[model samples]
Target chain A: MCGIVGLHLRDPALYPRLGELLTGMLCEMSERGADSAGVAVYGDPVWSPPGHATVTVIGAVPDLPDVTVISLGETHVVHAPVPVDALVAAIRAQLPDALIAGFGEELTVLKGVGHPRELAATFGLAKAQGWQGVGHTRMATESAVTPEGAHPYAVGPDQCLVHNGSFANHATIRRHLTARGVVFDSENDTEVGARYVASALADGRDIESALKSLCAEFDGFYTLLVSNRDSFAVVRDAIACKPAVIAETDAWVAMASEYRALVGLPGIEQARIYEPEPERIYAWTR
Target chain B: MDSMTIVMDKGVNRTLHRLDAGSVTITEPNGKHSVAVGLNAPLQVSIEGHCGYYAAGMNQLADVVINGNAGVGVAENMMSGSVRVNGNASQSAGATAHGGLLVITGDAAARCGISMKGVDIVVGGSIGHMSAFMAQAGRLVVRGDAGEALGDSIYEARLYVRGKVASLGADCIAKDMRDEHHAELRSLLAKAGYDDDPADYTRYGSARQLYHFHAGNEY
Candidate 1:
């Protein structure tokens, strides 16, 4: 089992407290998964500065000649005044063995193999300021408990996906994608799901359509929260064995594996809270 | 009878267990799992806020109420007594329960009474897909609509739905609502504090087609 939490702000007044709110939500779900944790922050000025592309590498890349590198615990954030594709290519060429955790124009992904609360402190997540954030705590059902196996798989440009349930037909789908030349980063089943959604989004389908395609092709129990620079979407499988609760107020929209993670949000008492129905896509946009 | 308030923390269930008879109010539940499970004595318990998984599991001779929403398996494997949820319930609300009356005033997610041996579940709002899958015995009554594949592979347990049924599951067929079935539905609804008419309901039960294996039904 795993835990997934995400926050999308509708009121700009709450932007400064994004990380603080998300940290509480993430830590409350520590009991769901304690093996590893990962988080993705969107529109953070310090983490993803304007007009500068960012690529997060999992391990130490001692020699990346001409880029600003910021080390946060186990992951390294590399910033350069170039396009996202160019920076990713450069990092891949220089550090052949380095794993590119995330890459986007307005996103920063940090991951580690440890307790979520400790990792949140190490990453200074409470001090982060952003418009959107997504976090995951994994119990390692499909892959090993390594930094590379953590979730919030940011495959496409500025897109991130986190899952709470395992995929039953991921191996078959992975072979299908592999036959079509889609390279994978890890053996984790969630990565396969992320890659599939990323490919669908690349083909110009909207987030809702992409997730619908995923539900059609993939067979499993899953509650997915996929986000990009502008949109946040949540979807569950047909059976919907995995639980998800969504609470929305005029100021923000939040989702988690359980309602406890959302009790700390502002105006929670008055918020419209409900569980997302099976096979339905609930999406919010900036 | 003594009345006291207890803030939920570690050993809260044990504290509730120690009480032989009293009215206890649980505050700040904060979605904690197994809040008042395994009760053997007659007690009146009320949870003021939302609860996590299995709030009153294995309850017997206790009347527990949740003022807010309940997470998965609210009263799983209950042997006796009553549990009520004022708000919605997640999946498997009364799974594998042998005896009791579980009431949900709001919608219940998937698998409302899975494998229920002999319990009575009444939902005020809709229920999600695959509810009452393989239910052995008991009665499940829904005031609102039922989702896809309701009562799949069901056994002796009777189902009464007042609203639209998206579809029926395999081996679960609609039966004529006899006078006795109507009386049973009315009693169950009254027990759940609903005024809905039993005449507006439909009954469903197992077809007994899959009870024994046959080569003709093989895939």
Candidate 2:
């Protein structure tokens, strides 16, 4: 089981309160799964800057002196370590968005293995501000508990995906992706989902079609929250055994495993709240 | 006049934990999961907004009224009392519930009353597929159409539908509505606050042929 929280802001007035609101949303779901946690924040100028590229590595950085290394919002960052030649190859491999941190034009993915609340505090999420944010609290069922196993698997450029249930056919799909030369970082099932979306986007598939393809490819119960540079989307399996709730107001669009995570948002009382339909993709763009 | 009012903005666990036998008002429910779970008192819970999964689960003698939409499995495994949803409800509206009167003013989605054991469910609008599967006893009244596989693998439970049924599950068949059935249906409709005549509905029940296995039956 896992808990996922995401916010797509519509009103610029609430931008400054992004981190604080997301922090409250994330912490309210700590009871769902406390094992590990991760988050992906978009539009943070200091973390990703406007032009220069960024990447988030799992462990200590490798020896590369030309790239400047910096840390922001408690998330470790290093300037583009990929040799110009390797960067293309890395993209070809469909590297995860969480692992790379900086994706596309701007994104910052921070992940850690610990209680969600503690990790959120350590990552300084209470003060981070962004146009979009996605957080996850994990309880390992198909994989081991490690930093790499934590979620917000943003494999696509400026894209992030967090899942609440297991995929039964991930191993088979992983094999297919591997045959097509998609190298994976962890054995986690959610990573397979992330890679699937990244692969689709790499081939120029739009977010809606990419998710529809996922509904046709992967099998199992799942409620997935996916976000990119311009859009936030949600989907569920055919049976929709997993739980998910979505609320949208003129100011923002929010989703979580349960409704408690959404109580902190502004205008929640007036928001249009509903559960996403099974096998249907619901996407909102900034 | 009032027992206590609990606000459920933070989470459902703490608010439901403090409920007692009195009039309780829940404000800003915001679709929180498991609201008013496992209540065993003669309490009245009025949820001011939409609520998430398992609202009033395992309830006994509690009257739960959701002012907005209700998520999945509302009144799950409820033993007694009533659960009323003013808006639409998601899947498994009264899954495995033992006894209670669950009324949904709007439509109820898939698997409504699945595995129901002696619970009475009244839906003002349509109900989705596989409803009342393995229902041991009780009545299900739908004012609108029923989806595919209605009452699949059903047991002694009674089903009444005022509109079309897309399909019926194995061993479930339509039965003639007698005077007693009309009276019972009238009472159920009255309890659910619908003024429609019970004679407009059709009754369905298990065929009883599936009770014993045949030598070459495909089943």
Candidate 3:
């Protein structure tokens, strides 16, 4: 079980209101899953820090330095201008189990084993600025509960996603995606959708076509929500074994696992809420 | 009489949500199987709309009322209490009835009262085929036509149909309806608001012949 929420604000000025609504939705939807929570907000800055953050890890620090290497054996210092590959290699060299998932120019993702509340405190999620994104709260039914199992998983540059349901042909799909240089870090079926969609787009398939192709190939229950800096998409599986509510107004479009979360939103009374039809796609831009 | 209320969804019936307190009025609110299966309360329930499948199975102490068409097994294993249907009833109206009363205001489908033990069943319309297959006890009084195999393997149960008897059960024959039976049939008809003539019927029962299931049984 998991809860996924997405919002595409047609009105750019409602950043604060959207943030409040998004937070409330995440907390409320957390009831479906309490393993982890993360949101990728678009176009709004909680407190703009930098265009990029360099989280450096030093190997076996014999001595502590006051410089950027202020952290001990393994450190996650949100520094600027650090190379991505060098940082990943350094962290992997020290802690081979290290996983570095990044998003957008400024917003970064850091997850570990804990509840949403605890992870939020550790990741300083409240301080992360808004970018177009999807949020996830995991229940860990088929997948393990670790940082790798956490979601809003980056499928591409500045891309993240959350999903509910299992893929019937997960192993076969994973094999096909693995052959295309798509990395598989977790055993979550939702991640297979992400990898396939991301690989399709990287091969010049547009987001719409990529999503359609993914649905055509995959079978089972799913309500997938994905977002990047420019676009967001929500797809209902063929059977609709999971629940997804879509509430839309001229100003904003919101998706949540249930209507109760949306009811607490600021403009909910003005929107129309409904269940997404089977095998349907709902996407928006800017 | 206490009461019970139940809410139903479409295509779902056979539900008798617990009864508590005096006579209850159940508003169907559009659902099927709203009241059925093992009603054991000492209350009364009045369903407001159509019901589906086993409206009152194994009814013990509660009185049941269906305002619309009843699906299969309207009152299957009634042990006590009373079931009154305002509309037509489907097959197995009171199969294996042990006690209590089943009153149908309109027509009844096949197997109106099969294997009746001790309960009394009253139907206001025509009964269909294979009714009262192997009745062991109780009485079935029909105010209308009866189809073929009216009482296929009759035992000790008594049957009275107000119309033509298409057939009969093994070692079974028609008997004369006495004064006491007339009084009881009239009371049941009156309860379901029927005013049909009771004289144009025939009574059927076992001769205690095949109650032991003879090896060489014949139709």
TM-score per prediction, in order, is: 0.97, 0.87, 0.53
Task: Report DockQ per prediction, comma-separated.
Answer: 0.73, 0.55, 0.02
Q: What is the lDDT of residue A272 in candidate 1?
A: 85
Candidate 2 versus the native: TM-score? Answer: 0.87
Report the candidate with higher TM-score, 2 versus 3.
2
Best by DockQ: 1
What TM value does chain A in model 3 reach?
0.82
| Per-residue C-alpha lDDT of model 1 across residues A13-119, encoded as one tens digit per residue | 99999999999999999999999999999988887889999999988779678788888987888988899999999999899898998999999999889999999
Q: DockQ: which is higher, 1 or 2? A: 1
Q: Rank the candidates by lDDT, best first.
A: 1, 2, 3
Q: What lDDT score is found at residue A211 in candidate 1?
A: 92
Better candidate by lDDT, 2 or 3: 2
**lDDT tens digits by residue: candidate 3, A207-226:** 77888887899988788887
lDDT of 2 by residue, A184-228 (tens): 878999999999999999899999999999999999989999888
lDDT of each: 0.93, 0.84, 0.67
TM-score of 1: 0.97
Worst 10 residues of 3 chain A by lDDT: A64-73
Off by over 4 Å in 3: A17-19, A43-50, A53-96, A121-131, B1-219
Candidate 3 residue-wise lDDT at A27: 68
